[model samples]
Target: MAPTLRLLAAELARRCDQDGPHADGTGTGGVAEMERAALLPPGKLLRPLLFTESAAATGMRRADTLAAALGVERLHVGSLVHDDVIDGDTQRRGRPSVVARYGLPNAIVTGDALLIGAFREVAAHTPASVPDARRLAVVQTLAEAGVDLCRGQAMEDELRAQGDRDVDRYLRMISLKTGALFRASCLGGAQLAGAPAAAQHALTRYAEHLGRAFQMADDLLPHTSDTATSGKSALSDLRNARPTFPVLLCWHRTNEQGRAQLSALLAGTLPAETAMETLRVLLRESGALTQARAAARAEAAQAKAALDELPATEARAALHAVADLAVDRDR
Candidate 1:
């Protein structure tokens, strides 16, 4: 890892692990443990890093944003807990999901606790050095992003139930589901720093494009990697019948007869094992994989371009590298 990234990771490990509320008056501690399980061994720490980096790019002190960064990460983890419950995914980052290890009720409570804790992290934990107005803006930004996330999740479920396969709508949904939080992390960092409007917009744009690329890359994970490598069930997307980008791409690129079979497969008319195998074959042969990769790259390129609006700082340069990583990473 880069020196800056390594330091940030260490900081996050220390700060995030100790921040959860223990026992909530009942002294049960189970909810806190579930929250710990969901958070410890943090994956990527992408949002917090982005938060700190975006703040740094504004010539602000990175250390001052630590509480807010922690808040954003908690919000992210909370959302992931909900995602696991919604998808019935038993695993995450090679560990049992919060819902899997703890029952659904505890998982829900854990998620809610994290959500409540996240707001407190922002409201009560921010340094006195941060201005009141800017702090309010940051809070509003995170709240709005959280709303977008919920909307996006609902949109995804609607797509699955209605079998709506519009690629444009899919992009919008992912932008809301994924990009909104990225925006909050980056935008909130800028807000905490009292950054000028222009810098905030540029950083937010960069984050949104990076987020789109990241999600596109994520959609490719099951198609390209095994459960061990991807750290999740390979058939998760197909099992949910979630209309992911590559799946839609494959649908659009294939012949009419292939489309018919794909529909039948999605509808469970065909044997699941056979459908999974056939869909993988079609994704490979139909050029959809390559096309999907290209789209992710394009979004990454846009993310990099957005950095051009910022001053030539090392922090901005790091953001540029992260954009490439978003698309090029395997997991």
Candidate 2:
């Protein structure tokens, strides 16, 4: 699994590098220097690689499979850049975020460029042997995912505006915001491989469960992991006022006095250190972390179960390993 995941990540990086045009050719004119400096170098590329492996497990030829995997990753990265701006984040992968380095407008354009570039890459590799309908379906699927991504963001914004989301509501919001892309990743991969409907459905289920577990782990990371280890701010989730699994869980389990403390923190008047301290106290006293961990474990099990529908193979084994990794990741 380690070797396969590494190879998948490397392949995704290679495709990302290949997809980029020269700096001058990237965004608008007169912005090439800034754009070049702000280029979001690829991250772990885990999603794309996993996606490609899923495709290969269904018998897609290696040469014909790379483009779709790269395309999927490009969409994921582009969304992240735009999402950072939306979330007012300043750092990513231990570096300045695109908006932080190049301003919001440029970051938006860069993300847009990545989106177009992804489609171009996908289109270029459509083998004549593959039906035109198949290519169109892939493109349409990606476009729909993009739309869902935007809808998810909008839903989060609505929740934030309300500012008093409960546990179930936050779960629903994050499920849409994060789970949609994971579903797309698996669905797209299976489609590219011409996998049977049953197989695709199983993979999609696996992705949704894994996505929920991944987000749960991510929500925990800000509180549990160090910045140096996580490659992002350790407390950004609280600082940004984003409702996470632990926060909601704590909100549910805490007594009135605890809720008052949390409410004060949410009111945005407390100092940063004090606010974080309050959050930590609420989480610890309410046993929210334990509950969140239990939920993640449950989701990871469900994700693994989804693989039961697939034929036993190295790829299936890797998928199960990934589920465990997602749930157990500390950073």
Candidate 3:
């Protein structure tokens, strides 16, 4: 891990590892325990890394962004908890999901706790060097991104239900669901450091593309990578009938006969094994996975290019490295 990331790991432990009493002065609720499982020694910690490196790129010390970084990580894990419940996913990061271990109600509460607690963490733990107004701005940025996350998830549900495959709609949904939060990570860091508008804009652009690239690679994992690497079941997207990047790309670019067959496969009209095999063949023959991979690389390149606006620094290089890491998940 990077030195800054090591520092972040320690900060996460110090802050997020606590187990306080529940309401009515009762003993610690298992919620705290569940939260610890979700957060401690976080996997990848990419959002936190983005926020901190963004601050670093703005000439702030790495340590100063710890609160901001952990806050985002908390929020990210909360979303994942809720996502596992919604998707009926039993596993996360090669372990049982919160819902799998704690049951649905407790998982729901755990997610809500972290989702709201993250905002509190930011509001209460901001560095003293940051002015009140910028602090408020960071909180506002996070709140708005949270709202966008909901909107995007709703949009994704609608698209899947209606079997809509417009490429632009898919792009817009991801920009909201995935890109908004990623953008917030960089924006929060820049805001904390009192960065000028131009620098903030550049980092925002970097994060936006990085998020898209990340989601694109994620969408491809079922098709291109092993189940162990993805930490999810095989052909998970197909199982869920999600209109992911490669799916929509194949839909848009395939011929009429292929579209008819693909639609049948996605509509769950075909036999399970047959649909999986035929769709896999369709995806390969259409080159949708290759196209999606190229698109992911393009977005990563755009994220790297956005760094040019910032002054050359180790922090900026770290930001570039993160952009590469986003797409590297597929490998």
Candidate 4:
């Protein structure tokens, strides 16, 4: 990990430990304990890293910037906890999920507590140089992103129920579900730094593209990587009857027979393992996998292009590397 990422992780762990209701020793202790476990290992730390690097690129590095980074990460972890409960996922990052370790109620409460803790962490931020109004803007950015995330998730559920396969719709859903937070991370970092509006807009666009690429790559994982490599169950999306990028691309490109197979698989009429194999073969043979990969690469390219507006700095270079990692990683 980069030094900045390490710093962000350490600070995030410290914030998680120090804030919230942990001191009460009541049931809140359980929430705090779960928060530490969920956040401390700090999978990727991409959101915080994005925020920190964005701040650095804008020539602003403060304790409050780190706090804002932690705030985005907390929101992310809370989303994951709630997602696990909704998806009935028993595992995350190769360990039992919060819902699996504790009961559903605990997982839900823990997720809510994390969100509250995120606000508390942000509220406590008082950068000596930054004004209170700017700090409040950061908080508002987070709040709006949270709303977008919930709207995205709800839209996704509705789409899944309708068996929607439109690529445009899928992109819009992911823009909200995944891209919103990425946007917030970059925007909040810039806001904390009191960056000019143009720079902030550029970073926001960069984050949007990066987030789309990140999710596109994630949608490919079930078919391209195994459980150990991906840190997720193989064909888990298929089992849940969710339509991902590769699946939708395959649907668009394949023959009528292939479409029937996909429909059966998605409708739960076909056996899951058999459907998974059939879809994988269809995706690979029909050029959907290549197309999906191309789409991810295109998005990453656009993300990098958005950075052209920023000053050339090591922090900007770090952001470039993050865009690469967004699509290149297996997990």
State which candidate has the highest TM-score: 4
- lDDT digits (tens) for residues 1-331 of candidate 4: 2888878878877766665653455644566788777786888889988988888889886445787788888999999999989988888888888999998999998899888777766778646567888888989999999999999999888889999989999999999999999999999989888899999999999999999999999999988788887777775688788879999999999999989888898988878788888888999999999999999999999999999999999999999999998888889
Please, what are the lDDT tens digits per residue for candidate 2 over residues 208-253? 8998899998899877877778878765666667778888888889
For model 1, the stretches where C-alpha displacement exceeds 4 angstroms are 16-28
Model 3, total clashes: 0
User: Candidate 3 — which residues are off by over 4 angstroms?
Assistant: 22-29, 270-274
Could you tell me the TM-score of candidate 2?
A: 0.91
Could you tell me which 10 consecutive residues in candidate 1 have the lowest summed lDDT? 19-28
User: How many angstroms is residue 255 displaced in model 4 relative to the true structure, after the best TM-score fit?
Assistant: 0.9
lDDT of each: 0.87, 0.76, 0.87, 0.87
Worst 10 residues of 3 by lDDT: 18-27
lDDT (C-alpha) at residue 76 in model 1: 95
RMSD of each: 1.8, 2.7, 1.7, 1.6
State every prediction's TM-score relative to the real structure.
0.95, 0.91, 0.95, 0.96
Model 1 per-residue lDDT tens digits across residues 1-331: 2755676667667764565554555423566667778888888888888988898999888778878888898999999999999989999988899999998999899999887777888888888988889889988999999999999999999999999879999999999999988999999988888889999999989988999999999999987878887788887888888899998998999999889877987887766677889998989989999999999999999999999989998888888888988988767
- How well does candidate 3 match the true structure in TM-score terms? 0.95
Instruction: Count steric clashes of candidate 2.
Output: 0
The per-residue C-alpha lDDT of model 4 at residue 182 equals: 96
